[model samples]
Target: MSRPVSTYRVQLTPDFGFAEVAKIAPYLRDLGVSHVYLSPVLQAVPGSLHGYDVVDHSRIRQEFGGAQGFREMAGVLAAHDLAVVVDIVPNHMNTANAQFLSVLEEGAASPYADWFDIEWREGKVIVHRFADDLPQSEHYTVVDWREGPGYRRFFDVSSLIGLRVEDPAVFFATHEVIFWLLDEGLVEGLRIDHPDGLADPRRYLDMLRDRSGGVWTVVEKILIGDERLPDDWACDGTTGYDVLNRVNGLFVDPEGRQPLVALFTAMTGQDADYHAVMARSKRDVIDLFFRSEVERLARVAGASVQDLVDLLVEMPVYRAYVTPGEPVDPVARRIVESAAPNPEIARAVLYGSPEAVVRFQQTCGPVMAKGVEDTALYRWYPLACLNEVGGEPDRFGLSVEDFHDFCAGMRPFTMTTLSTHDTKRSEDVRARLQVLSELPGEWAEAVRGWSRQVSFDPHLDYLAWQTLMAAWPISAERFTDYLLKAAREAKTATSWIAQDHAYEEGLRAFAAKAVELPIGDFTALVDRHAVANSLGQKLVQLMMPGVPDVYQGNERTDFSLVDPDNRRPVSFPCAPNSAWDEAKLQVTTQALRLRRRLGPDAPYEPMAAEGEAAEHAIAFGRGRAVAVATRLPVRLAARGGWGATSLTLPHGSWRDLLTGGLYSGRTPLAHLLSRHPVALLERHDL
Candidate 1:
């Protein structure tokens, strides 16, 4: 039997649909991808690019080639020895059109009321008044009844209502679609999206897996820094960002830590305690975006509006581990107090005092990253800088042993992701961002000078770009619209957004000029800024091991900032075609080929060797295949690299595939690796 299909994403609704999929299947197959991952195929709000907003769970969307087309696509994939992995949104469904509107119109009396999670009292529909920033009272309406013909109440999103998966009836009703697909063998795996938003994640996962005959299941879970997924769930590893951070973080310059912190401080004066910084940022965001909902909630609670305020502000952040009905024990005030080294400081700036922290601990002891209030915040802060607080490459605020423990537990199932639907930027986009992090005082000066030359506000432009680029890290599809918004809101030419095409052109030129100098020269001028981005990308891809993932169209280059820009489709012209980009193809093909030749199941032992320029180069071996790469090309290996500059094979000769050089047991490795960015050698025992 063929191996399971894996490493894919969904593309929905085009004149193309499955037929279009057939066209790309060959390209994907060549990349060693097993499955053609798909977005939801269930009936959804018309013209939905991502099928998250399903309208009817039972039927295939008529616009996406429906059931017949879906079946045909599966057949084509099977013929190519590939499987289908369809994304399923069990948390909520879309209420965007007439069908859902009718459900709301019918109120609680509708027969399908129990099909949702309804909290109804009397005839009033109690929709959550989301935030204080929106003009809901004057612009939108709410009712007391929680259930309607097609609509139901979810946490805060009435437009995208929730389903009570905990309810057996609801589970059964929703599983109808799942059952049909699995029974027919239409899909072999399921990618559960937004699992953090669900009430009972483990239970839902177990049920879905068990019901599907142990079908391959991966979830859309976001695990920060050291958080691990529940081991109890029967599933394969996550969609793969957990590993992304480790690999990415390894190449970061430890020396740049203090400087980057200082730069942000100079730029954003509000930098205080990291947690406080995050809280203030989030508060501003909520105020700006959710104002109407907050105001409406205040109005509904009447005179006890203070209670409403307290709930939203004082409550611990809700996530996968804290949803209702899960085991929760309020932590004692004493326990919280004892856990903190500085109770007063924790009380002053953190989200909760010792008491509230204890309450959370009592509820979810041994929960993912809840042990450290700061750790949790750093992981969830969403800003890369804030998250980078104490994670230096050679040193860490958290103990390395503890970090390892966390990594071990997390390795089995945690979602290893670089980008998500909620992230500000994509992994590739962020990799480009690291170019700035590596720069010491020098790159900042260059940027300042460049800003002066361009006749633009450098700081403002950088800020705009940061804001704009932030969204690229997320997995959402509406990224381009976000980009356009960034452009419109840019305060300067240097800002992420610009006045026109000319501004974008100028900004690109600046970046191009930024990378023009030699790596050593650049690093000398600004503390390793030159090698930082490339180093960061390589480090993340190779070292911090997990199920490595490559975001769509990011294998070769990533210039996206925020949503609209990042969400642009992979056009044949601009997008890197593995068949065309020789450099990228060389890297990707070599990496994948090495992984295959080593045999995925082979045990790997870490080996260390001294290079002629050890500081500028690192060498390690996987089985008999030794790999070496130079970090800063100017720095040669220190110990003369065995003086021979060639590597010795165990018994037989080794071949350098890229350079077409052959070596025996007496050759010096350094000489062979001299002209290459990277070198790999494999010795077959046979």
Candidate 2:
């Protein structure tokens, strides 16, 4: 397997693409990255910033400079010895894609009808934007759009159509461009997007492996609490949410669990159960976002499919893999089998058939994506930092032993990252929020005071306060947009399709008041804590057992919120704050260089610290390289700043890579870390 020691994630769009990336290849190489991991480069919606919503899979997106631009970029990367890995959106295609348009224009007679996962039982393809088909006369007909048109789509996106990739012809047709790119050596590996949305993720991966000649690959799989990736999948591993959640778990102060919960309960004035909230959210998604799916499935079942809807709504994981030839997993089988249990013959009408089972399996993805990711995550208000993809915010923290075990097991195949385009908050934002645990009393006091100034849904209010506090130097417009998206996703007071004007007005008012709030002290607090966390987490991820991929601007103090905001341009112009980012970049470059030199397959061992600040430090060693990062800077200060804390290291003179200081076996961690929040040490003679 060809694995990159360090990968840099680039969000390719009309604004930044092949030309710009090629220009930066030397800079990235100098920054010590072994590869460039990129967003989808295929033709997509004209101005799509993040290119997951692809329209044409057969050609390179012209907005990003087309095939020639891609070749030029690849040449530059090869010149710098950097590998290329790109994201592929195979689960769905742009609704306006040629294949989908052909199906709409020609109906069942089109050669491309089978390419899409369309219901067709509705008799005609539902056209939303167009009036009719071309007057030149075609094989079939396109009709006017009707209310609640029946078709399959990507989540709630009306224009993104899901593909029937399970079909061999459809798979080959959709992946033709990707294969050509791989064969031509312009791209080396693939990052399969949203495999959970496919009928058989394992089968799709197997197909990808065979077609790509078994190049390195990882799925964009979100493994919720203890949900291990199936060992049978023919890919390297997941896109690393499994370990991303684990690494994020380390910063959480276990003691802050109740305080944050209690604060949330007090602010919201509702003792909302998480499971109950999730159930309601999922049901909302089923009834509103995916109503057409349920209605279509009902047509297939030849009756009301409320029973199947319930079965799908209650599914614990994403879509179950129900393949044609592969052996059915007993656990997956039980989930479906239990949902449609009927030994009696009359009951066979509902779900005894395989077709009903297939529809149910397909419905699970849209439901889970809308429910957990869109709704529940926004409604969840404990500590927003813990509310990351594949991370359970309810689960407070993981022990050092469990963290080490997780890394050791999933090291080689997994791609670990602290921040991504989809994360709820940036790494610095999360780091500061984790500070709330150490200062629970202060946090509650601050939040209560902020409430008096501005008020909204308790859950939304709490999330907003923490987000603003993390990045208080934010613009008012940015704050309003962030809060509005949060409210719509939560569906507490308003939504995307519908809005409660009165409730929305209150949300907007709160955003305005928040901008006027006196947040200088809070901003200082966030900056100080974020510095410690930014260094600590970065060092750990670089040294941990995996191919670490750094999101574009996150090598510095990236206090960005979620998507669009996180995906903004990466710039480092000469400014007052340039020193701070430059320092972080220095640390990152040093760490990546060390990783390149030492290699990744190293023995793992956890280090113990002895001192008053023992609880505030985490230490681990990978071969001769040892990384120590400070955990709770707020708590450390409160308790007189790492009083007598010391970490025992491997004997012999060790040089600090970050700072040029030297140390031996028993070194005082506090004195050593006083200069910087993290230390990367290697033996004097490696």
Candidate 3:
């Protein structure tokens, strides 16, 4: 099980199962990925679109072709020189899981009682159910849906119950099938989903590594600004939200902040301060959705519930990485010391009850997910491109030097991705939106025109305008669904638990009218620049320091918005439908193939550009391979279009893999990028 040079992520559903993946083996190989990264393949709740709601781990999903189908798919991939990397969910499982049902029926007397993270009180387990009248069970006590189940869960999803993988028996039992897959050489790598939710991620990973012979592993860990993965964690590196944010930031303009904020404030009549909006959203979610979780923590820690709530709302990162019995990591200690409203509570979390510390750490991740990524990101999105899972909307851009520093320190085998099953928008859609940061005034005027034609809630209208523009040509139905979801997630005009029917109806009508409005002209205005950004970002992502992953269908221009939309069935064996699509496909293919040749240990050096337009070019080298892409295309065009910019090659003749143009010595940027906005060059001594 060697590390993958790169992976192509496919969202496998009931319709597109292991057999369908096998059909794409030749295409994935031809497209140049070393492996096909499949979403959760374990049996999930029947017909689950995204397989995160796994129901059983002991069997391969029947809908996904079961054991036999998986074997057939693996054989085809192996024949094509491709491998497999599976997304595994160890944190939680669907409540309808057999073991969980047994727990419900037999409680403490059940053979599988220790498998779940349920808290027992007087031999009765409390469970949350959505019923007008609570049903009584001798071994279970049913509570209101709003109450936190007397058990740990994944985020606020009650239907997904947490697993007690900290127990050795539970870990081995749940991972039996996965271990079998590894032994049979059916899977080569593992992508651990939501490691932050684990009671002891470090210990869980240690056990996994010890048992599985340490095949290449990465965690779905979201690192905040300047937050580094703990060196002690037994994994390769993060799934690459850190790299995604930095790469996304390279194309954003810091200068656009003030004007964009002003325009957003005027249009939406909402607070322009991102931090304030996020803080308020955090507080609201705790009260509205996490009251039960807070109550449970308070009862366990003997700390005031309000203090715990305040601390959770203020905590900066997802988890503190407090390992209960072990000494708190310096980083975790510092974060808790800084964020805690009371020093006593901080001490409790740091050196208090093991159960208390673990619960607090688990609670922080859900709060951040529900608060910032889901709520505030939707509420105050002046620039929607910055609203990714681990991105900071207020932080506008990254300096070239800073970006290089970030890349230089990356773990070689760590996964670096621009898009995934979880991204709010696809890479191309964000590329289009990034153009708006450069042309805020034009965007503002277009929004004004659209607003004049059709209007909804101002809070939602601002986000709707951005979404509509980024994913233009989207159907009225698709656009309507996206807006409704955004509005509910924002929890401003409407919410999932509490619906505003009248406002939702208006939003539906608005979507239909807004899509029909004269919006294509505006999209056309930014189309060329957007194309440049798209190619520029794609080339950089594919050639950067880590193992880059191409989300399904993103090798071409994919203008999808959020999930269900982003997860739509991709037509395989795809051909270029347009010039932009062809250009993007060429870039993706050339870069991935070059990376495969370079291997994982190639040295990276920042290649500096000289002359007037030097700032506009981002050039880097990996062994004999070089990647040069234009940044801030609109600004570059405004500043006279790469007049005298030149990059000195590594003292040899070089051929552009993209266009086959030859170059040596001081190559002029204007000539190198004359054909496309990006160039992938290979040094050729001949």
lDDT agreement with native, every candidate: 0.48, 0.78, 0.91
Off by over 4 Å in 2: 130-149, 298-304, 322-327, 333-354, 456-459, 572-580
Model 1, runs deviating above 4 Å: 1-6, 13-16, 97-102, 126-157, 268-273, 285-423, 453-460, 465-546, 572-580, 593-600, 611-676
Over 1-686, each residue of candidate 1 has an lDDT whose tens digit, in order, gives: 22242245545655547767766766666665566667678888777666777878778878878889888888888787667777888878865534334445576656566556444545534553333442332212454323222223233345577677767677777768777888898877777876654556777877777777777677765455444566666677666654555545433445556765565455444243554543343343233233333333333323133332323333232232432332332332333334334444224212333323322322221122122222223222212432321222222122223323444454432234454433445554454445444444655564345345432333334443343333223332333344334334322222221256776555455444333323234323322232333433443243223433444555454445444454556642224543323444444445545554554333333333343444443444455565554443222322334353443444666665556576666555467665555555566444
The full ranking of all candidates by TM-score, starting with the best, is: 3, 2, 1
Tens-digit per-residue lDDT, 237-260, candidate 3 = 989899999999999988899999
Better of 1 and 2 by lDDT: 2
Instruction: State the local distance difference test value for candidate 2.
Output: 0.78
How displaced is residue 658 in candidate 2, in Å? 0.5
Model 3 poorest 10 in a row by lDDT: 128-137
In candidate 2, how many Å is residue 300 off? Answer: 4.9
**Native-referenced Cα lDDT, model 3:** 0.91
